[model samples]
Target: MRCDQVRQTLEESGEAYPAPVLHHLRHCPECAAYEHHWRWVRAGLLALARETAPEPSLGFARRLIRRLEEGFLPMRLVGEFFETAGRRVVYFTLLLATVLLLAIALPSSGPLRGRPARDVSWPQPEIVATRDYPIPPSELPGAGFSLTSESDVSGGQK
Candidate 1:
């Protein structure tokens, strides 16, 4: 087997070498040296783990508890507020009222706030002008234009 593969297997299994790797290590000096080095490294790590374990600084637990409590306080307050049916109903009512007010006020405020001012005066010819254009008789056929009553359109009912 390759030295890297044997090394990975040794590192992972930590004392469980397969028969092929054991035979290969016996025949290969480079792989045997690597196995010896890895064994020494593992022994050192075990000794380190057996020695003094790490301890947190003073008040570390208390500070962590305080931070967690502070972070959750607002969420807890909101949860309590929603837990009561009255508060939940009141909150939804206010929200709905606000949405309704905005819906009504925004559209109606358009004429007051968004529209341009009356630039044309009351007697302005442009505003008062008729949209109609009377067609001249010359434009009509020899079945000339006439009206007997408002209903008699053919222009002349021929």
Candidate 2:
């Protein structure tokens, strides 16, 4: 077996060396050194496990829980609001007020206000009634010639 496989077996088995691992450890000096180092580390960890851990001062947990339950005061909550979102809201309001003030203060002739109106007058179209033109003699039906007015064509009383 490889040195890595032997070391892995030693780490996995923990104090119980398999037959193949024992054979490898006897042959590989580096693996034997690694196994020795791990043994010392395991002994130290075991010693630490046997000793009692340090305890917190009495009422520490109760005080912490009470503080969490009590929550923040209204003024402190307001202060926190100002520290975060309130400041941004104030800045945005100030910016909007400044833009509105500039729009009101500046003259209409300003570049951002757009182009001024020009004095342009288009020619008026001439309106000609159909009755204004005399009918051609050749276009009239045989033996009868009539000129109709706007009222006659529109079914109005003649």
Cα lDDT, all candidates = 0.73, 0.78
Q: Local error of candidate 1 at 86, Å?
A: 48
Residue 27 deviation, candidate 1, in Å? 0.8
TM-score (all chains, Cα) for each model: 0.37, 0.42
On a 0 to 1 TM-score scale, where does candidate 2 land against the true structure?
A: 0.42
- For 35-140, candidate 2 gives per-residue lDDT tens digits of 9999999899989999998899899899878877897356777789878897899899999999999989998864787655542444433432244555444455
The C-alpha RMSD of each candidate to the native structure, in angstroms, is 15.6, 16.8
Cα error, candidate 2, residue 122 (Å): 41
Candidate 2 lDDT at 15 equals: 84
Candidate 1 residue runs with Cα over 4 Å from true position: 57-59, 64-158
